[model samples]
Structure formats: structure tokens, C-alpha cells
Target: MESFLETFRNLDTSQKILYVFGGAAVTAVSLVAIRILTLKEEKRKDYPRDKVILHQIGRGPFAPSMTPFAVKLETYLRMARIPYQSQGASFNIFLWTIRRHNKKQTWNQGHGRHTEEEIVEMMNKDIQSLSDFVGRKRFLMGDEPSEADCSVFGMLSQTYWQFYGSGYENLIKDRYPNLASYCERMKDAFWPDWDQCITHGGTREATK
Candidate 1:
């Protein structure tokens, strides 16, 4: 412990920063590797040839970006009782990039700053694609939630919550009743404090 403390104390500010970042990078890579290994081990043990794994990636709630995909996937999963893991992608990437480029003023230009027409057009495209995916089917893959459902839902839910009560509210909730209902069901089932949790936005609390 003394040696460790001495070594830590010897680190300069830059070294300390490097240590911190290096530690984080190592931890992240380790986690990814471990996850892969664990999945492989699980596959080996259970060896279900038919089983599929899904990965969903997206930004957070402020973007109003990925919710439709998530909502649709969640509904399908509930309807089908498919087990999945939800992974949150970094919204910080977009936020930081915008800030770094000093594009904050023009951030909404396309959606946040741009004309309402542009925003509407983007939303319409998203909705149309989502609708086509969901269609009359009970899920993404015909009356059953498959890997695709899980992947898409994670993204859509994040988007929906991020933009909730904002200008895009009607564009999402009002426009797609089935999708909205799906989101509500997911909230009730998965998010215990659905209203408060989803509505009040910040970093999502880490789950076990």
C-alpha cells in the first residue's frame, strides 16, 4: 500500500491524467473482451443453435433520435417475451463534437436550429421507416420479437425519452399511436418510475 501510494504521488498532473484515461480505456476494453468471452462461454454451455444475440447502439434522450426504434423493439419483446440486454451509447459524443466545433448555435439548424420544415421532413422519414418495419405484424419479425426488435427498441426508447415534452412530442407520440402505446407499456413494465425517470433527463442511472 505504501509503495502504491508513493507511485501514485510521483505522478505529475499530466501523468495523473494519463493514468486516469489509460485506466478507463483499459477497463472499457477489458469489459468488452469479457462480455465477448462470457457470451461465448454461455453459447458453449447452452449451445442453442437457434438463439440469436442482438446489439443496439444510440444516443440519449435529448436528441429525440432513437426512441421510435426502441419503442417498437420493446413492444415486440414484451409481446414475445424475448430476453435482451440494453446498452446506452454516448450522447456526449454528439454534444462534445457540437461544442468543440462551436456548432451549438447551428445545432438545431437541421433539427434543433434549422427550419421547422427540415425537422418535420426528418421526422416523417423516420416515422415512415419505423411504421413500415412495424406494419401489421405483431413484432419486427412477424408476431414475434426477434434480435432485430431488441436492437431497434433500445435506440428508439432513448430517443423518445430525450425529446419528450419538446416540440417533437406530437411528431412521435401523437403521430404513432401503436408506437406510443408500445413505449407506454415498456415504461410501465421496465421503468418503475416511468414518468419521472424518462421525463427528467440526465445521465441514466447505472443498472445492475
Candidate 2:
């Protein structure tokens, strides 16, 4: 320990600083390389690109208000035979986190009010916007499931399926029958195990 200390002390301040920086850089590079290598190996073992189009659906576990978007998107994807995955959670958590971190803001700033009612309203508006975009077309962008469909479905499914009894269900199911039907058909077609996907505790079941 004494020899190590002596050796370290022998170096000038700039050299010592450079040495620390270099060591940090090397460690960072090594960590990054390890992560890349690990990810590549995992990808090779778990999710091969040749198998399916790796798409993920995202939503919150509690906010059922996002259903319209999810259902519509799922319909388009199923019709177009686009393979994807669903990630259910609070719809805005990931995006809100990104916004907060990237712009150096708080969660409240990144998102609006934190009440369930507010969340439900936001989701309703978003879905309505998506529906308007879909118009009379059988799908979101014309008769085909575009890349946009995948994203829209992921968000919507979480809201509709997960937030069934959480006060948002009435807002959605009461007003959007087409959207409700769309969700039913999508679930029946794509996710036969719909009950299992219920991240929130089972309560208000999705009506067909």
C-alpha cells in the first residue's frame, strides 16, 4: 500500500488527473463494450431479427384511458400481419421520464396534472385524435397497418385492457363502441390469452 501510494504521489498533478481520466475512460469503454457484447449475445439467443418484426406495445397498468389507440393500432397490425410485442404500464411513464431527463424538468412539467381523472381525459383526447386520423379508413393510414399503427396499438391496449375498473373505462367504453369492438376483435385474434395480459387486477372485464 505504501509503495502504491508513493508511486501515485510521484506523478505530477496534471499527470495524475490525466491518469484518472484515462482510467475512467477505459472503464467506461470496457463497460460499454461489455453491454454491447451481452446485448448481442442475448439478441442472438432470445430475439432473432429473422423471426419477427420486434415491435413493443407500451401503456400503464392503471390507466385504462389509452384503449382507443391500442385497439385501433392492434386492428391495423393484425390486418397487416405485423408481428410485435406489447408492453403495458402507465402510458406516459416512459415518455414522461424521457422528457423530464432530456429537458431537465420535473414529472409534473413533463406531464400535466397527476390525478386519475386528468390521466383519463388525456388518454381519451389522444385516442380521439388517433380515431380522427383513422377517419373512415379500415386502418390508421389507409387500409394497411403502417409503422404508426404499431406504436398506436401499444399505447391504446395498455389503457383499455389495464385500466378497466379504474374510472377510465366508463369514459372509453361508454363513448367509443367502434373502438371497443376493435379492441375485442384484436384481442381475440392476436392475444387469445387476454386475461393473462391484464397487468391490473381483474375487475371490469373488457366487453365484447
Candidate 3:
């Protein structure tokens, strides 16, 4: 008998078409038969992929930013190579509470001026601290992003993008433009779904 390859090569076009299709059908049938004989049919169980919940720290009017703790958690998750789902919320309640306390003069009387000045001074100090930390690098840490950058970016994004907040008066833009730009860069890096992260409470998958 001719070798299988030689016999196939010698077949006419019509015969070859029939042979190819017939062989495919036979192979499919054989596979189904073997599967039926050897494989047991088990009910499929759906299990979600293991993932952590990423909690966003600060919530602005149109966007949700991270807190220092949230940033650290995010960095750790990235380093560990684990999947995560995020949820964003705001601190307006807490912020309003603080303002309420301030207005009541609970701390030092309802002296908005004094409080404003003190807050500005504190912000100035924060800017200086970041300036010292960043020096002449892309981020607070260096060329590579670190946990600290995440925290700093979250904080600065609030100051830069969030104008509704009490102290978010373009301070980052006026003073630390570098840091403002850096926040943008980091946002591009970490949060690819920028608008979605903000709109759907920071949880991209949850939106769907």
C-alpha cells in the first residue's frame, strides 16, 4: 500500500477535498467518543479571581484621590503582583466636621483668618518638605516610582485638581508645578481608567 502522504498527494482535487473533510469529521468523532468514554461530566463551578479591595482615601467633587495609607497599600499590591478592585469615597463629611469644629471655636475660636493663616503656613511647610524630598528627580523617591510617590501624588492631586476643598486653592500649581506634573504622570501610569476611576467610585470592574 502507498504511504499515506504519497496517497494524499496523488489524489485529484475533488478527491482531496473529500478526503480532507472526511478525515476531519472522523477525528472529531473519535475525540468526542474518547471524551465521552474517559471523561466524567462535572458541573462547572464559577469562582472569582482572587483579588484585594483597593480603598481610595480622599474623594473630591469630581474625582477620588488616595490617602497616604491607600497609596502604600496600592504600592504593596503592585509589588506583590496581585489583582485588586478599588472603591473611592470622599472625606467631605470629615472635612465638614472639622470646619464645623473650627467654626465653633472648639480648637481656638471661630477665627477663620487665624485658621486660614495657620493652614497656609502648614501647607507651605508641606511644599517645602516635598521640595526637599523631591530635589531634582522625577518623583519623591527617584526615577522609579515608590510608595512615597503614590502618597505624595494623591495629596498633590487634591491640591492641584480639587478646587472645591477648603485649602485646595491652586497651591500645588502655584508653588510645586513639578509635583503637579508628576501627579499627572503617575495617574497615567497607575490609573489607566482615569475618568472611570473617578466616576464609578474608583472601582473600574465594579462599574461593569
Tens digits of per-residue lDDT for model 2, 118-167: 54455567778766666566546665446665555555564455433344
User: Which candidate model has the greater lDDT, 1 or 3?
Assistant: 3
Candidates in order have lDDT scores of 0.43, 0.43, 0.47
Ranking by lDDT: 3, 1, 2
- Those runs of model 1 whose alpha carbons end farther than 4 Å from true positions after fitting are 1-95, 101-116, 185-208
What would you estimate as the lDDT of candidate 1?
0.43
List model 1 lDDT by residue over 1-53, tens digit each: 22222333343332322222122332233335445545655556543445444
Off by over 4 Å in 2: 1-109, 112-120, 192-208
- Candidate 2 backbone overlaps, count: 12
Q: Please say which candidate is ahead in lDDT: 2 or 3.
A: 3
